[model samples]
Target: MPSVIESEVLIRVVEPRDLREVYEVESMSFTGSLTYDFSVFLFYYVTAHDLFLVAEALGRVIGYIIGLIEVRRREILGHVISIAIHPLYRGLGIGSKLLKALEERLTSRGALRIFLEVDVLNKPAISFYRKHGYVISGILKNYYGVSDAYIMVKEVGASLKQF
Candidate 1:
């Protein structure tokens, strides 16, 4: 089977066995005021199957998207809790691919929309998500300890280019 990433780095669902790399990417990609501890990753990254995703390059995972499901008044949605790509692999479409995969999975699971939050100062991420059809729907005041966040949401099943 062809690897998910074109450069032999495959984007795949995060399995229980991939915890070490997942945690490593989680720490390496996220810092400053909002880092989740290893125990939190271990406990929440998987529940029966997976609550996370990773991009693997030559047997090593270099990126991940961690998230959860939500429901309100019987409307279910997939929330893209977090996403990251290794510094070495930035700008190679890895983050976009991983995010697309997550959205695909969530849509297949009957999620009508996927939402996420980005730091107000995260220009690259905001631009990336906007490119992928996620729009800023609202903002959270003091979303983080010091920084505000833009809440973005995208409806699933908008468009699919050829494989």
Candidate 2:
């Protein structure tokens, strides 16, 4: 989590100039989102411009989440590929804020719902989404080339059913 330093923080779309910093975060974050032998994160960095996002604190990039819309079943939905916060900055609500920001971006693009495939072993992320109103729709076997994927979804607005 980021410190309560009252820094200027903003969430914005990924721009060309941000590629370097974004890649640095990607390289330091995780492998699935890395795509190209964990190098520069080029698989999506160079391919999906609109799906990338960066959270800048002060003048440095602090957090980021990558997502894109893809066909599931017969409809299109937003899928968050990755969301990471600097190790020292964990527990600051950065990941939640980034997810919400991505949801807004996906919604503006006609996405009726948002979804993600997270590692079943990633207890924190799964707990975070489940607590944030995301339900585990299903589970995919070896969805990420090596591990299973927990398919989670969150419907836009409100639903009649409440836990």
lDDT, model 2, position 60:
76
List model 1 lDDT by residue over 1-163, tens digit each.
Answer: 3234556767776777887777787678778767777776676755514547788887888788876778867988888888887777788888877887778777777788889999999999999999988899999999888999999998776463321
Q: What is the Cα root-mean-square deviation between model 2 and the actual structure? A: 3.6
Candidate 2 lands at a TM-score of: 0.80
Winner by lDDT: 1
Clashing pairs in 1: none
Would you give me the overall lDDT of model 2? 0.74
Q: Write the per-residue lDDT of candidate 2 for residues 110-159, one digit (tens) a residue.
A: 77888888888889889988877889999999887778989999887444
Runs of candidate 1 exceeding 4 Å displacement: 1-7, 158-163
Q: Which residue pairs collide in model 2, if any?
A: 1-89, 1-90, 1-92
